[model samples]
Target: MTNPTPGQTVSGTITVAANATDNVAVSSVQFLLDGQPLGNPVTAAPYAASLNTTTSTNGAHTLSAKATDPSGNVGSAAGIAVTVQNPTPPMTCFVLQTSVTARGTGTVQTGAFSTVISGEVLLAFVSMDGPGGAAGQSATVSGAGLTWRLVGRANSRSGDAEIWTATASTVLHNVTARSAPAKGGYAQDLTVVAFEGATGTGAVSTGGAASGAPTLTVTTTAATSLVLAVGHDWDKAVARTLPTGFAMLDQCVDTAHGDTSWSEYTNQATGPAGTPVKIGATAPTSDQWNMAAVELLNSGS
Candidate 1:
């Protein structure tokens, strides 16, 4: 058997594969889950089935295969024990932008703002007004007793933008932003745009890394309903590779100057509980302007 190994945990749809041998030429092979037949018997090699585990109970189950030969002989393999898990609940995300403010000529700026809804996970994007040419200039958004993770970066006609996320409520306080070597020339205006979501009975977790490269990897705690985002400072053409069990949600590219670019990607697929989400970029340089973030929600079961 190639899937649903003994003690393996499964959810959603899973592929099962098996091989059988018999004397006097094998006539057919039949697969079963918990003693129930799965489709019809197979008379050829590479026997397989796509089984949806959502219909079964959220616990242990058994899988077996029986083979019959043309000589009227039959043989069966011992049942493989597997665990079934429930699917994660769907999530809805929204975005809201705040009024703009000036960051002055200093390298660092801090301010406070309130969220549109109470008790929602906030993914804040800070846009800076610019004639911005300062390399490695970055921003941070934080509030509600937690510092948000920087998952994205972009450049707008106004300036540069940094994206951050955290689990908090409506009233955010002491949100801060800082840039290295001070923003030169004209002072830039800063605006906050937030992406929020209500996880009803589910929880959200966020994290990221900024080592100045195209790819970033983050770890998450939720086994299901997992979502992820990766933000890079430069707008180079890049692709995202997700860890197992996660699927792509969206990929975005924004550039203010043709040479400088910012990009972000969203994914819904993640591995089982306690698994680290590894994200990769196609053409990552040793630039220290890249970051990644992840958000996870439970199945609400």
Candidate 2:
């Protein structure tokens, strides 16, 4: 009761201490939480007990202590009220829920992808028509009762690759995307992937290229982050292996414009600061391409 003062907010493991001075020699002291014995009684000075706040509910708690003399006389200290607020454990890794891919001209809509948990993170990678400019074409995604934000993009005459993200409060089904200046003849490929346990924030690092292979690299702040790499092939080639150490999420081809788009992700943590996560430049080298990457963080990162 002396360590955690009344109305104090505590988290993690904390020590509960008390003082007892008996007229006769104090035989033992016992600490209690909400009138229950905290641990074995202490027979020495500096009476205290270790309490893990995480084990208790995150609300008001009471602490008190009792002391006894040899004659069985006991004295109890007035209970002191305190609050427990334990931190949420950090997510060890991101769990893949579902992914959907699509191809079409103008506005692109992905097929339905389901998730069992709410507050899940939805990442959409869209390969849209880029007229070879300094920047990639801007596109917006809608659906899942969430607000989408563009993470990064890579633009080239071949095509444009972009990464967008949102947090779904309810179950998500389909997603729709359209370029800022919609063009009927401009074809696009969409890949929507969902994961649970993300913080729903922007990428820790982003990288892309207008042609050839991508040299985008990201150094993850947390080991639990999801590293996403996407590319758009202007040649409309759909058959290509993903970079080493990454698992393919989804890929699509828009035959109308002869453009193909593919996405891949890895939950593995890139080592130290100097070491970075990257997509190898070997695959999909036959075509002019645009590549983009984003690293979404895990919860408690």
Candidate 3:
């Protein structure tokens, strides 16, 4: 009897023999598996059997070889074990991140965002960090803005939406993640990152990439000092007059946010000798400036 190999459809042969009585003619041979007859083999002295390919998997099978000689003499042989193995399949996976920073603040802000197609998060790095501070951090998360608290977690979220809000008082957020159903498709990431907006500046670039995964880069621009002015009711013990290298670069004829009035300004292009200084300052009150919301630029490019 003939059969395919364990994993494949194989062919096998069975031999029949007869004593020198009469020229033995063949009667029939049978193929069996697991004590059941597979099929009839009624050809020549050497009989063959065929096995189906579908029946084989990643295991072993038993095939029996039984035959009858022309003399009507029948004999059965024990089945042999045949093994078939399946081929291993290939694998697949993906990643997504930001190459740009948040718009409001000059500093770059990035983290894993959710998928547009399935709402799955390829990455989720949002929320705030450090000591207790959330009131001033109440940001309007547009794409999916999360509120920051003292620790690196969200105190609450301003909101999320498919459409953009147009209010100047409202801060808008956009997605940083690639949609699972739209383009890239790895949605199990949950690494959150948020930037407390304070007018910092910088650029972004994809950092190092994982061996087979992708990396994202987000950069921003920011300044260490803001060109602002204030009165000398400023305390030296509680708060010193900037304590260091900071001079009024400009001043305003009026006030806006309750601080002393001032407009945005920069140093004179040519030299420090001609650098602009804050005007209208008297003794007890000094025209001054200091690191402006400088922490926001920590991730600056």
Q: Which candidate leads the pack in TM-score? A: 2
Name the lDDT value of residue 223 in candidate 2: 53
TM-score ranking of the models: 2, 1, 3
Q: Write the per-residue lDDT of candidate 3 for residues 167-199, one digit (tens) a residue.
A: 112222344421111111111111232222122
Tens-digit per-residue lDDT, 77-162, candidate 2: 99999888779443344556667777766776766555645567888888776555445465667765667887877764446777
Q: Model 1 — which ten-residue stretch has the worst lDDT?
A: 200-209
Candidate 3 weakest ten by summed lDDT: 158-167
lDDT of every model, 2 decimals: 0.49, 0.68, 0.27
Error of 3 at 178 (Å): 71
Question: What is the clash count for each candidate, in the order shown?
Answer: 11, 1, 32
For TM-score, candidate 2 versus 3, the one ahead is 2
Task: Give TM-scores for every candidate, taking all chains together and pairing residue i with residue i.
Answer: 0.36, 0.61, 0.22
What are the RMSDs of all candidates, in order? 17.7, 17.0, 29.8
- Following a full C-alpha superposition, what root-mean-square deviation does model 1 have from the true structure? 17.7
